[model samples]
Target: MSIAVAVISSDTEYVTRMMSYMKGSPIYHTWRLQLYTNPERIHQLTELERMELIIVEEHLHSSLLRRLQAGGGQLDELVYTSKRGAIPIIVLAAERRELLEHELYKFQSVSALLHGMQQRYERFRSGHAKKRLVTDDRQQTIAFCSTLEQAGKTVMALHVAALLASKGYRVFYCNLERWNTSDSFLAGRVLQEQAASYSDLLYVVKSRQNASKWLAEHAAAVEEYSFYMLRPFQHEADRRGLTTEDAQRLVAAIAESGLFDHVLVDLPAGLDDWTLPLLQQCHAHYMLLLPQPGWQRKHQLAMSCVERHNAQALEELQHKRLLVLSEPYGNCQPGSSVSDLESLPYVEAWQQGDPVLLGSVHYRAAVERCIQPLLTGEKVV
Candidate 1:
């Protein structure tokens, strides 16, 4: 399952350092690295040892490119064959300089170099490679949204993702909220040196590039929770500039990537150009409602506005929408008017000032029951 990579560099010392770092890093388990101190030895890559990626030192890049263009070797055959063609070539420079599409600076940390290589390979695969075959059982996309602030939509979304992952399903949790707070609850935050910002991923999506590869490369695993999650947006403008088309394409790429069994999206309150498409694209929409007065009216107004813009989208939302009453603070009793609707029980631990409410077993069990019908494809009674 490891991705094959070959590095050709005349700098013996640099190659040694890189090999040492790879041996000590977690990436060693995911990538197979082959080092070559002589550029001519690259021809030794036979059919038995095909490389998915090739990295050339700046001094040897030109000569390698020429040889590749001239053709007639195992390397040439590997790069030109239809079945495994379009293997990516990356150039590593000694210092920061005007870089080409696949060129990277060499003096950076090994982690950064590996991250850059993964990003380049994914872009090449998404744009130049053929599409992968999708199976009959397509991945399901679920959205958690609410019109009221503090409605616990994100809390519910994370719990559902945890439950699904525990049940042996691969889950990718995405937070689309303009101001995301999921990080406060999740474990294993990406190291600052290894972090890939959401803005960079958004730019790839906006350029009409497939986001599946980006997700595959950058999605951080929440090992403590047993699910994967994309980093939240760091800036306001980046989230604000997301278009309806961008939203649709991003969701479609993740759902169709064949990487996960379920895609859980946490969305901001209200429907606009950005959120409308997402709401329409999801297989099921879980709308969290607070027990406070007038919250239902606000949701109705939001639906009415969406209807005015796209009637068909409104119809789709109505068809798949599930209303959940969130009573996290114990403001309402079980026998209240909203009792018929699916309700999340109030956990006293949260009221007792537990910061890590996401780990609450009682709350997660309630969310599991609320989402069980959708997971089983059964109608909610």
Candidate 2:
């Protein structure tokens, strides 16, 4: 089904227009177009490798067509535009037929002729009834927070997005670190253009910058956060770069965007200054963990952040369950294992929290195992 189509015409505009139409056709997925802007290049393709179709304009030098015929180029079809027509030539001319008959006899291989090539393609596609699949609403967003030490967040986000999209959700991969790469906002434009279709928009929030830009870009998606943190960043110096107030504004904007019915914010390890404020902003918060020795340190921070933030936010935080990211990279340090996480005392302490323990996600292939299932609503092993 993969056919190569060559358009031989000096009018790049017409060539481009024809190709554009071809690209959107049902056969488009089956064919690839190559432009032969010069006649010499056309001569380069051997007879054995001639394209499936050769579209040429009559204005092209006669020597070029002779070169094509010499190259053993037997196109599946030839569409020629000229003031005169002959057998098998698709004549495109405003002039009378008498002028074309003389020229038409010069070519013997033309099998079919159509005056308007563009309209022919349209009729061909309509006869086939090629339906364009419109994106619909079934989007879901999940927040992913990993210790800054691991840059695995991006991998996790993209994996989930692809999985959900494959399963029929209008999934978006949001990158907070680089605001410009916000997928939800980018998808928003597509959603607006096809307003009749219901396409669920899932936004992955990685950081405050992600939230900030989504607001600025006016991306609409069902709000979902991997986690929400009160203290977005720790360094007092970095705090000056963006404030809690700015984050709050972005949060409000997201809430109002109609992007998601559920928003999950992935919280970073340890409740810092941003923890309380962020918890207050979200409808839900999850104390995500990777059952390891660090749980002890993480537990203390979580408790402190939950308690100090506000009783209500703390209750909200407590009600949220422990989301154990079971998957660990296979290349973990030789000695690292799940048992290392089980021994952490903080796990037991967390069990007694306000939200209570939600159960555990055993380490597995996070993207292929965990993320794909979550996005696709399919069971993961």
Candidate 3:
């Protein structure tokens, strides 16, 4: 299938020249391209076609981002609204980058820049779907979150939960990603009751009734990994309407029910409004940083906000905030002060739904160092 891509750039001259010569670019035959020098046209594309990749120029969303400034909305709200501003949205900047914010590849010639962009397009198409999901009973709840798209937060959560289950820990990996897709079918398909979904789960949690019966009767498992999995809500608004109270009641009841040893939560990239308060109650948090400054900054900000709001979350984050760094592009400098875990090795098994058992040297070492300690009967911290 041809990858559907939208490329937005503010520089007209660059767009003009590239549009003239792009037919010769490597992806002309293998992919479909839509070009715009303005971001406003995004709404048009969003309504017309489903984009596999969205590449927008830096500063295109500047006005929206202004919401993050001192007089505007706070960072979390800014990201919540903008959908991706928690990380300095990637930009096309020159060599000398500020705090390396708005970092982009610079080129002496337009051809070189286009080539780099094309390379990114190819890499993104090939590896983007590679992913996180969870929290625990042996210990307590764990959160998997990232600052930006394609940062492997889902992959880490799923792997950890699966690995823990492999060792006989009763684990349930839950997805709260908001965007509804049946990706869980890859984990395990269930003979679901037509009404089985977040809507039912929400009612059960909010009413404080019938959860044990519902879970026993309807819960599904990703068979080989031995961890339970839950799909997202049937309707988008159902998830959007989920409140902190709703999530808190749901996760708390699940964790305290003695049905499993741990519960792993797969959170959205920008902490959705619903995820904020539920976050305050988590026992441990993992912020996975891709090899980009934008990603690192968002991961740190997520940690900082959680700490500031919840005293207990802060204390645990101080000791258990997991900083996972992916392989570096050059030399990567992660600035978080919490405990650092090892970098993840990209395993081919991940795309096949078997990453839980991907026993790469670095992955195994990380599970032992970071997860083993919590698999006992104690909350992290």
User: Which predicted model would earn the best lDDT?
Assistant: 1
lDDT of 3 by residue, 1-381 (tens): 365555667677776776666577655665576776675554432221354444455566464334235233344311221232112133465454452322346434657766655555444322221111223214468887665666666666767877777666678877777673325424334435473676778878877687877777666776676788665687778888777677777787667766776788888875544555555677777766666556556776876675566656445345656667654233345563422555665655556554334446555555555564353223444
TM agreement with the true structure for every prediction: 0.59, 0.35, 0.52
Please tell me which model should have the higher TM-score, number 1 or number 3: 1
The alpha-carbon deviation from the true structure for residue 376 of candidate 3, after best TM-score superposition, in angstroms, is: 6.4
Cα displacement (angstroms), candidate 1, residue 10, comes to 76
In angstroms, the error of model 3 at 121 is: 46
Q: Model 1, which residues run further than 4 Å from truth?
A: 1-136, 187-193, 208-210, 304-311, 333-335, 351-354
Best by TM-score: 1
For all candidates in order, the CA lDDT equals 0.72, 0.39, 0.58
Ranking by lDDT: 1, 3, 2
Across 188-226, the per-residue lDDT of candidate 2 in tens digits comes to: 322333321111111224333454444434443433422
User: lDDT of model 1 at residue 162?
Assistant: 78
Residue 113 lDDT, candidate 2, scale 0-100: 29
What ranges in model 3 sit over 4 Å off? 1-139, 180-195, 271-274, 297-316, 327-340, 348-365, 376-381
